[model samples]
Target: MTERVCVGAIAGAFGVRGEVRLKSFTSQPNDIAAYAPLYTEDGSRSFTVRLTRPVTGGLGARLSGVETREQAEALKGVTLWADRDKLPALPDDEFYHADLIGLSVHDTGGALLGKVRAIYDHGAGDILEIHGPGRRRVLLLPFTRAFVPTVDLAAGRIVADPPDEQE
Candidate 1:
């Protein structure tokens, strides 16, 4: 697991002011600001988030040193990461997307399926994208208790009950 987890992203400038259109990945969207002093992916720079208001697609927020529209615009597409310690702990059933990625997947019969490449949330629920070995095509499995039976993070593996092979 990483020391820092991605919490939000800067969509772009909200208006002519220094406020940025921020997209929060946190469970509670507004909690993104509570985990202040977020850092960039490479940990090169950091910003203290102050959410101004809710905008069309996301939230309007201002960064510590961002005082101009140009500065906010320049931060577009930048993912904001917060220290893992600052985030709340999850229940045993819940797992972080970052922790699931790259984990080897297997069936109840111990047949290797693939590795988790990514996780997607299309509003309804989470989906795991598995790829490699016998999986010639990307396998998108719903990350539900029915499909995913066990996730042993310490073992770096996932036990899945995938649907029958597609022709």
Candidate 2:
């Protein structure tokens, strides 16, 4: 399958008439529906979203082919994907979470720290979860210029300046 980016997720049924609760991952939440014909993770099904109203935690939307509350409820927690090419290009300082995962990480002194396993954005900022080989623990490095001086996407590596030992 070609490259795809996760743009939104179904949070379950919103009302009794088949409307669904959607949590968008895009910068502009409403833009999730603009990328029409979003596909499921496995590409088994596709949906054309029409956002109806804003609801708590997400937006109320209607998906094509989903005509009943039961059908919408069944798709709870399903992540919506869009073709990478269809999405707008990001700026130099911005990056897609998919692009950062799996990239190797190194300290300022060129020591191998770990590889990026995941990225999380909990309102404040994005955090890079890095784990080294044979290690069970992970380092949650904030994706800020202070800690991460360089992000070499071309080289598939990041140069981080981790803080001193924890007190």
Candidate 3:
């Protein structure tokens, strides 16, 4: 698991001011500001986020040191990361996306499946994208208890009972 987890991103300037259009990835969108001093991916820069208002696609926010529209625009698409220790701890059933990514996956019978490449949440629920050797395409597995029975983070593997592939 990484020490820093991505919590939000700058989606360009909100208006003529220094405020930015912030797309938060937190479970509670507004909670993104609570984790202040968010850092850049490389740890070269950090910012204190102050949300201004709820915007169309995301929240409008002002970032520390971003005093001009040009500066906010320049930060577009920059993902903001928060230290893992600053975030709330989850229950046993919950897992952070950073911790799940790259975990080796296996079937109930112990056959190697693939590694988790990414996770997506599209209204219904979260989906796990798995990729492995010899696979022509990636496998999109629904991240449900019935399909993914076990996630042994300590062992760094997942045991799944995925549905039969169509092809």
Candidate 4:
């Protein structure tokens, strides 16, 4: 698992000021600010976030050192990452997206399926994207208990019961 978890992103400048349109990925959108000193992916830069108001697609926030509209605009699309230790602990049933990525997947019978490439939450629920050798296309599986029966993080593997694919 990575030491940092992506918590939010800068969408663009919110207005003429230095405030930015922030798209938060936290379970509670407003909680993104609580994890201050968010860092860039490479950890080369960091910012202190202070939310101003709720905006059209996300929250309006001011970032430290970003004092001009141009500076905020320059940060557009930059994902903000927080230290894993700063985030709250989850129940056994819940897993962080970072922890699940790159885990090798297998079927109940022990056949190698694939490795988790990515995870997506399109409002309804989470989806796991798996990719493996010799497969032409990636497998998109619903991240449910029925389909994914076991996730042994310590062993770095997942046991899935995916539905049969038609031809």
lDDT of 2 by residue, 72-112 (tens): 99999999999898899988888889888999999999999
lDDT of 3 at 23: 94
Pick by lDDT: 1 or 3, better one: 3
Candidate 1 per-residue lDDT over residues 1-167, each given as its tens digit: 98999999999998887999999999989999999899999999999988999999899998999999999999999999999999999999998788999999999999999999999999999999999785678989999999999999999999999999784
Candidate 1 residue 133 C-alpha distance from true site, Å: 1.4
lDDT of candidate 2 at residue 137, scale 0 to 100: 72
Instruction: Point out the worst 10-residue segment of candidate 3 by lDDT.
Output: 158-167
Q: Give the number of the best model, judged by lDDT.
A: 3
Query: Residue 74's C-alpha lDDT in candidate 2?
Result: 99
lDDT of 2 at 133: 80
| TM-score: the better of candidates 2 and 3 | 3
Model 4 residue 137 distance off true place after TM-score fit, in angstroms:
1.6
The pairs that clash in candidate 3 are none
Candidate 1's TM-score reads 0.97
lDDT of 4 by residue, 1-167 (tens): 89999999899998998999999999999999999889999999999988999999999999999999999999999999999999999999999999999999998999998999999999999999999987778899999999999999999999999998653
Candidate 3: what lDDT? Answer: 0.95
How accurate locally, in lDDT, is each candidate?
0.93, 0.92, 0.95, 0.94
Candidate 2 stretches greater than 4 Å from native: 134-136
TM-score of each: 0.97, 0.94, 0.97, 0.97
- The lDDT, on a scale of 0 to 1, for candidate 1 is 0.93
lDDT of 2 at 94: 84
**Could you tell me the lDDT of residue 166 within candidate 3?**
68
